[model samples]
Target: MIWHLIAAVFAGLGAAGVGLLLRLVSGKRLPRWIVPVCAGLGMLAYQINHEYSWFDHKQTQLPDSARVVDVEKGQAFWRPWTYAFPMTTAFSVVDQDDLITGQADGQRLVQYRRYRFRKEYVDQVTHQAYLMNCTSRETVPLAGEPPRPRTEATQTFTETDPLFQVVCQQE
Candidate 1:
Protein backbone atom coordinates (compact mmCIF):
# COMPACT_ATOMS: atom_id res chain seq x y z
CA MET A 1 0.00 0.00 0.00
CA ILE A 2 2.79 2.38 0.90
CA TRP A 3 4.56 1.55 -2.33
CA HIS A 4 1.44 2.39 -4.34
CA LEU A 5 1.11 5.73 -2.59
CA ILE A 6 4.73 6.48 -3.31
CA ALA A 7 4.27 5.60 -6.97
CA ALA A 8 1.20 7.85 -7.24
CA VAL A 9 3.14 10.73 -5.76
CA PHE A 10 5.98 10.20 -8.20
CA ALA A 11 3.53 10.03 -11.09
CA GLY A 12 2.04 13.36 -10.08
CA LEU A 13 5.49 14.88 -9.74
CA GLY A 14 6.55 13.66 -13.18
CA ALA A 15 3.41 15.11 -14.75
CA ALA A 16 3.98 18.38 -12.94
CA GLY A 17 7.46 18.41 -14.41
CA VAL A 18 5.94 18.01 -17.86
CA GLY A 19 3.61 20.90 -17.17
CA LEU A 20 6.56 23.04 -16.03
CA LEU A 21 8.41 22.11 -19.23
CA LEU A 22 5.41 23.14 -21.34
CA ARG A 23 5.23 26.47 -19.55
CA LEU A 24 8.91 27.08 -20.18
CA VAL A 25 8.62 26.09 -23.83
CA SER A 26 5.63 28.38 -24.31
CA GLY A 27 7.48 31.26 -22.64
CA LYS A 28 5.05 31.19 -19.66
CA ARG A 29 1.97 31.75 -21.79
CA LEU A 30 0.28 28.61 -20.38
CA PRO A 31 -2.18 29.22 -17.56
CA ARG A 32 -0.89 28.92 -13.95
CA TRP A 33 -3.47 26.13 -13.30
CA ILE A 34 -1.96 23.79 -15.88
CA VAL A 35 0.62 22.41 -13.45
CA PRO A 36 -1.92 21.37 -10.82
CA VAL A 37 -4.34 20.05 -13.43
CA CYS A 38 -1.67 17.89 -14.99
CA ALA A 39 -0.58 16.66 -11.58
CA GLY A 40 -4.17 15.65 -10.63
CA LEU A 41 -4.67 13.88 -13.93
CA GLY A 42 -1.42 11.99 -13.48
CA MET A 43 -2.39 10.83 -10.02
CA LEU A 44 -5.83 9.73 -11.27
CA ALA A 45 -4.24 7.91 -14.20
CA TYR A 46 -2.01 5.97 -11.86
CA GLN A 47 -4.97 4.95 -9.73
CA ILE A 48 -7.03 3.82 -12.72
CA ASN A 49 -4.13 1.82 -14.09
CA HIS A 50 -3.63 0.19 -10.73
CA GLU A 51 -7.30 -0.79 -10.46
CA TYR A 52 -7.55 -2.16 -13.99
CA SER A 53 -4.35 -4.19 -13.77
CA TRP A 54 -5.30 -5.87 -10.48
CA PHE A 55 -6.37 -9.14 -12.11
CA ASP A 56 -3.24 -9.43 -14.21
CA HIS A 57 -1.06 -8.47 -11.29
CA LYS A 58 -2.69 -11.13 -9.12
CA GLN A 59 -2.33 -13.71 -11.87
CA THR A 60 1.39 -12.99 -12.13
CA GLN A 61 1.71 -13.58 -8.40
CA LEU A 62 0.01 -16.98 -8.51
CA PRO A 63 1.96 -20.23 -8.62
CA ASP A 64 2.47 -21.95 -11.97
CA SER A 65 0.04 -24.72 -11.06
CA ALA A 66 -2.83 -22.28 -10.58
CA ARG A 67 -5.31 -21.91 -13.44
CA VAL A 68 -7.70 -19.04 -13.98
CA VAL A 69 -11.13 -20.59 -14.62
CA ASP A 70 -13.48 -17.60 -14.73
CA VAL A 71 -13.70 -13.81 -14.75
CA GLU A 72 -16.56 -11.51 -13.66
CA LYS A 73 -17.03 -8.19 -15.42
CA GLY A 74 -19.32 -5.50 -14.05
CA GLN A 75 -20.46 -1.91 -14.58
CA ALA A 76 -21.11 0.75 -11.97
CA PHE A 77 -23.35 3.79 -12.26
CA TRP A 78 -20.80 5.88 -10.39
CA ARG A 79 -18.19 5.01 -13.04
CA PRO A 80 -19.91 5.87 -16.29
CA TRP A 81 -17.09 4.48 -18.41
CA THR A 82 -17.97 0.94 -17.25
CA TYR A 83 -21.53 1.11 -18.67
CA ALA A 84 -20.30 1.10 -22.28
CA PHE A 85 -17.73 -1.63 -21.73
CA PRO A 86 -17.77 -3.68 -18.56
CA MET A 87 -14.53 -4.02 -16.62
CA THR A 88 -13.14 -7.17 -15.09
CA THR A 89 -13.34 -6.58 -11.39
CA ALA A 90 -13.44 -10.12 -10.06
CA PHE A 91 -12.33 -13.64 -11.02
CA SER A 92 -12.05 -17.26 -9.90
CA VAL A 93 -9.15 -19.65 -10.03
CA VAL A 94 -8.26 -23.20 -9.07
CA ASP A 95 -4.94 -24.77 -8.28
CA GLN A 96 -4.55 -27.86 -10.40
CA ASP A 97 -1.77 -29.17 -8.21
CA ASP A 98 -4.00 -29.35 -5.14
CA LEU A 99 -6.92 -31.23 -6.69
CA ILE A 100 -7.74 -34.71 -5.43
CA THR A 101 -9.85 -36.98 -7.62
CA GLY A 102 -11.28 -40.37 -6.76
CA GLN A 103 -14.22 -42.69 -7.22
CA ALA A 104 -16.75 -43.18 -4.44
CA ASP A 105 -20.24 -44.69 -4.41
CA GLY A 106 -20.20 -45.11 -8.19
CA GLN A 107 -19.53 -41.38 -8.62
CA ARG A 108 -16.47 -39.43 -9.60
CA LEU A 109 -15.59 -37.26 -6.64
CA VAL A 110 -13.33 -34.23 -6.80
CA GLN A 111 -12.02 -32.25 -3.86
CA TYR A 112 -10.38 -28.90 -4.39
CA ARG A 113 -10.12 -25.33 -3.21
CA ARG A 114 -11.73 -22.47 -5.12
CA TYR A 115 -10.30 -18.99 -4.85
CA ARG A 116 -12.37 -15.89 -5.56
CA PHE A 117 -10.81 -12.48 -6.16
CA ARG A 118 -12.74 -9.24 -5.98
CA LYS A 119 -11.66 -5.61 -6.37
CA GLU A 120 -13.45 -2.96 -4.33
CA TYR A 121 -12.53 -0.16 -1.95
CA VAL A 122 -10.22 -2.75 -0.45
CA ASP A 123 -9.20 -5.90 -2.33
CA GLN A 124 -10.92 -9.06 -1.05
CA VAL A 125 -9.87 -12.70 -1.43
CA THR A 126 -12.14 -15.59 -0.51
CA HIS A 127 -11.31 -19.29 -0.46
CA GLN A 128 -13.89 -22.06 -0.51
CA ALA A 129 -13.52 -25.82 -0.50
CA TYR A 130 -15.89 -28.11 -2.39
CA LEU A 131 -16.64 -31.75 -2.92
CA MET A 132 -18.17 -32.26 -6.32
CA ASN A 133 -19.45 -35.14 -8.40
CA CYS A 134 -17.87 -34.74 -11.78
CA THR A 135 -20.29 -37.14 -13.43
CA SER A 136 -23.42 -35.30 -12.27
CA ARG A 137 -21.86 -31.86 -12.01
CA GLU A 138 -23.29 -31.50 -8.48
CA THR A 139 -21.52 -29.48 -5.80
CA VAL A 140 -21.51 -29.30 -2.02
CA PRO A 141 -19.62 -26.41 -0.43
CA LEU A 142 -17.22 -27.48 2.28
CA ALA A 143 -16.41 -23.99 3.46
CA GLY A 144 -16.76 -22.76 7.07
CA GLU A 145 -19.52 -25.15 8.12
CA PRO A 146 -19.25 -28.85 8.69
CA PRO A 147 -20.97 -31.11 6.21
CA ARG A 148 -24.18 -32.77 7.34
CA PRO A 149 -24.57 -36.54 7.03
CA ARG A 150 -27.39 -36.12 4.46
CA THR A 151 -25.40 -33.68 2.33
CA GLU A 152 -23.05 -36.41 1.23
CA ALA A 153 -25.81 -38.74 0.14
CA THR A 154 -27.82 -36.24 -1.93
CA GLN A 155 -26.36 -34.22 -4.80
CA THR A 156 -27.57 -30.78 -5.86
CA PHE A 157 -26.80 -29.48 -9.34
CA THR A 158 -27.29 -25.82 -10.08
CA GLU A 159 -27.65 -25.32 -13.77
CA THR A 160 -25.70 -22.74 -15.80
CA ASP A 161 -23.16 -21.97 -13.10
CA PRO A 162 -19.62 -21.56 -14.37
CA LEU A 163 -18.19 -23.01 -11.17
CA PHE A 164 -19.50 -26.45 -12.14
CA GLN A 165 -17.58 -26.24 -15.41
CA VAL A 166 -14.49 -25.08 -13.62
CA VAL A 167 -14.64 -27.91 -11.10
CA CYS A 168 -15.72 -30.66 -13.47
CA GLN A 169 -13.12 -29.77 -16.11
CA GLN A 170 -10.28 -30.83 -13.85
CA GLU A 171 -8.59 -34.12 -14.58
Candidate 2:
Protein backbone atom coordinates (compact mmCIF):
# COMPACT_ATOMS: atom_id res chain seq x y z
CA MET A 1 0.00 0.00 0.00
CA ILE A 2 2.80 2.35 0.92
CA TRP A 3 4.54 1.53 -2.33
CA HIS A 4 1.39 2.41 -4.30
CA LEU A 5 1.13 5.74 -2.51
CA ILE A 6 4.74 6.49 -3.28
CA ALA A 7 4.25 5.65 -6.93
CA ALA A 8 1.16 7.89 -7.17
CA VAL A 9 3.06 10.77 -5.63
CA PHE A 10 5.90 10.33 -8.07
CA ALA A 11 3.46 10.15 -10.96
CA GLY A 12 1.81 13.37 -9.85
CA LEU A 13 5.18 15.09 -9.54
CA GLY A 14 6.25 13.98 -13.00
CA ALA A 15 3.02 15.28 -14.52
CA ALA A 16 3.37 18.55 -12.70
CA GLY A 17 6.89 18.90 -14.13
CA VAL A 18 5.49 18.30 -17.60
CA GLY A 19 2.84 20.96 -17.07
CA LEU A 20 5.53 23.37 -15.94
CA LEU A 21 7.55 22.67 -19.06
CA LEU A 22 4.49 23.23 -21.23
CA ARG A 23 3.79 26.56 -19.56
CA LEU A 24 7.39 27.62 -20.09
CA VAL A 25 7.30 26.63 -23.77
CA SER A 26 4.12 28.62 -24.26
CA GLY A 27 5.80 31.73 -22.83
CA LYS A 28 3.63 31.80 -19.67
CA ARG A 29 0.33 31.79 -21.60
CA LEU A 30 -0.92 28.81 -19.59
CA PRO A 31 -2.33 29.52 -16.13
CA ARG A 32 -0.33 28.61 -13.03
CA TRP A 33 -3.17 26.30 -11.76
CA ILE A 34 -2.67 24.04 -14.75
CA VAL A 35 0.28 22.37 -13.00
CA PRO A 36 -1.75 21.39 -9.93
CA VAL A 37 -4.64 20.18 -12.10
CA CYS A 38 -2.27 18.05 -14.13
CA ALA A 39 -0.82 16.61 -10.95
CA GLY A 40 -4.27 15.66 -9.62
CA LEU A 41 -5.27 14.08 -12.93
CA GLY A 42 -2.04 12.07 -12.99
CA MET A 43 -2.69 10.61 -9.53
CA LEU A 44 -6.28 9.74 -10.41
CA ALA A 45 -5.18 8.12 -13.66
CA TYR A 46 -2.71 5.93 -11.79
CA GLN A 47 -5.39 4.81 -9.31
CA ILE A 48 -7.88 4.04 -12.09
CA ASN A 49 -5.32 2.02 -14.03
CA HIS A 50 -4.47 0.08 -10.90
CA GLU A 51 -8.12 -0.79 -10.22
CA TYR A 52 -8.99 -1.70 -13.82
CA SER A 53 -6.07 -4.11 -14.22
CA TRP A 54 -6.55 -5.83 -10.85
CA PHE A 55 -8.39 -8.87 -12.26
CA ASP A 56 -5.80 -9.59 -14.95
CA HIS A 57 -2.99 -9.05 -12.43
CA LYS A 58 -4.49 -11.59 -10.04
CA GLN A 59 -5.20 -14.07 -12.86
CA THR A 60 -1.55 -13.95 -13.92
CA GLN A 61 -0.54 -15.00 -10.42
CA LEU A 62 -2.63 -18.18 -10.52
CA PRO A 63 -1.32 -21.54 -11.78
CA ASP A 64 -2.04 -22.83 -15.29
CA SER A 65 -4.23 -25.60 -13.92
CA ALA A 66 -6.48 -23.09 -12.17
CA ARG A 67 -9.77 -22.39 -13.96
CA VAL A 68 -11.91 -19.33 -13.36
CA VAL A 69 -15.41 -20.36 -12.28
CA ASP A 70 -17.09 -17.03 -11.46
CA VAL A 71 -16.54 -13.31 -11.87
CA GLU A 72 -18.16 -10.25 -10.28
CA LYS A 73 -18.02 -6.77 -11.70
CA GLY A 74 -18.58 -3.70 -9.54
CA GLN A 75 -19.86 -0.20 -10.13
CA ALA A 76 -20.03 2.49 -7.47
CA PHE A 77 -21.83 5.80 -7.37
CA TRP A 78 -18.66 7.52 -6.25
CA ARG A 79 -16.78 6.04 -9.21
CA PRO A 80 -19.22 7.01 -11.88
CA TRP A 81 -16.81 5.92 -14.57
CA THR A 82 -17.24 2.33 -13.40
CA TYR A 83 -20.88 2.34 -14.59
CA ALA A 84 -19.60 3.00 -18.08
CA PHE A 85 -16.91 0.35 -17.82
CA PRO A 86 -17.37 -2.07 -14.95
CA MET A 87 -14.31 -3.40 -13.13
CA THR A 88 -13.95 -6.97 -11.91
CA THR A 89 -13.97 -6.78 -8.11
CA ALA A 90 -14.14 -10.48 -7.23
CA PHE A 91 -13.72 -13.92 -8.82
CA SER A 92 -13.65 -17.64 -8.02
CA VAL A 93 -11.12 -20.22 -9.16
CA VAL A 94 -10.78 -24.01 -9.08
CA ASP A 95 -7.66 -26.07 -9.80
CA GLN A 96 -8.06 -29.14 -12.02
CA ASP A 97 -5.00 -30.87 -10.54
CA ASP A 98 -6.50 -30.80 -7.04
CA LEU A 99 -9.75 -32.54 -7.90
CA ILE A 100 -10.46 -35.85 -6.17
CA THR A 101 -12.93 -37.88 -8.19
CA GLY A 102 -14.86 -40.90 -7.00
CA GLN A 103 -17.94 -42.99 -7.65
CA ALA A 104 -20.38 -44.15 -4.96
CA ASP A 105 -23.86 -45.65 -5.25
CA GLY A 106 -23.60 -45.36 -9.03
CA GLN A 107 -23.10 -41.58 -8.73
CA ARG A 108 -20.00 -39.62 -9.72
CA LEU A 109 -18.64 -37.35 -7.00
CA VAL A 110 -15.79 -34.88 -7.06
CA GLN A 111 -14.08 -33.22 -4.13
CA TYR A 112 -12.42 -29.86 -4.71
CA ARG A 113 -11.65 -26.47 -3.25
CA ARG A 114 -13.15 -23.20 -4.43
CA TYR A 115 -10.83 -20.21 -4.15
CA ARG A 116 -12.59 -16.84 -3.94
CA PHE A 117 -10.61 -13.66 -4.44
CA ARG A 118 -11.94 -10.25 -3.36
CA LYS A 119 -10.40 -6.88 -4.03
CA GLU A 120 -10.10 -5.19 -0.68
CA TYR A 121 -7.56 -3.21 1.30
CA VAL A 122 -5.47 -6.38 1.71
CA ASP A 123 -6.70 -8.38 -1.32
CA GLN A 124 -8.64 -11.01 0.61
CA VAL A 125 -8.76 -14.71 -0.38
CA THR A 126 -11.28 -17.18 1.05
CA HIS A 127 -11.40 -20.87 0.13
CA GLN A 128 -13.86 -23.64 0.92
CA ALA A 129 -13.89 -27.36 0.20
CA TYR A 130 -16.83 -28.81 -1.70
CA LEU A 131 -18.25 -32.24 -2.52
CA MET A 132 -19.94 -32.13 -5.90
CA ASN A 133 -22.36 -34.80 -7.11
CA CYS A 134 -21.82 -34.43 -10.80
CA THR A 135 -24.50 -36.90 -11.72
CA SER A 136 -27.16 -35.03 -9.76
CA ARG A 137 -25.91 -31.54 -10.59
CA GLU A 138 -25.64 -30.68 -6.90
CA THR A 139 -22.87 -29.28 -4.68
CA VAL A 140 -22.40 -28.83 -0.97
CA PRO A 141 -19.60 -27.34 1.06
CA LEU A 142 -17.61 -29.58 3.36
CA ALA A 143 -17.70 -27.45 6.48
CA GLY A 144 -16.75 -27.80 10.18
CA GLU A 145 -13.55 -29.00 11.81
CA PRO A 146 -13.76 -32.45 10.23
CA PRO A 147 -15.35 -30.91 7.12
CA ARG A 148 -18.59 -32.86 6.79
CA PRO A 149 -20.91 -32.03 3.92
CA ARG A 150 -23.31 -29.19 4.73
CA THR A 151 -26.47 -30.50 3.17
CA GLU A 152 -28.48 -27.48 4.36
CA ALA A 153 -26.24 -25.23 2.30
CA THR A 154 -26.33 -27.46 -0.73
CA GLN A 155 -26.91 -25.91 -4.13
CA THR A 156 -27.98 -27.30 -7.49
CA PHE A 157 -26.47 -26.17 -10.77
CA THR A 158 -27.37 -26.52 -14.42
CA GLU A 159 -25.31 -28.07 -17.15
CA THR A 160 -24.16 -24.65 -18.39
CA ASP A 161 -22.85 -23.54 -14.99
CA PRO A 162 -19.12 -22.93 -15.05
CA LEU A 163 -18.49 -24.54 -11.67
CA PHE A 164 -20.33 -27.67 -12.64
CA GLN A 165 -18.57 -27.86 -16.02
CA VAL A 166 -15.12 -27.55 -14.49
CA VAL A 167 -15.77 -30.06 -11.70
CA CYS A 168 -17.48 -32.59 -13.96
CA GLN A 169 -15.62 -32.19 -17.25
CA GLN A 170 -12.93 -34.73 -16.32
CA GLU A 171 -15.44 -37.42 -15.44
lDDT of 1: 0.82
* Alpha carbon deviation, residue 113, candidate 1 (Å): 0.8
Judge candidate 1 at residue 133 and give its lDDT.
84
TM-score of 2: 0.96
TM, every model:
0.83, 0.96
lDDT of 2 by residue, 61-133 (tens): 9999999999999998988999999999999999999999999999999999999999987899999999999
CA RMSD, predictions in order = 3.2, 1.1
lDDT of 1 at 151: 65
lDDT, candidate 1, 116-151, per-residue tens: 989887789999777888888776767445643336
**Per-residue lDDT of 101 in model 2:** 93
User: 105 in model 2: Cα distance from truth in Å?
Assistant: 0.8
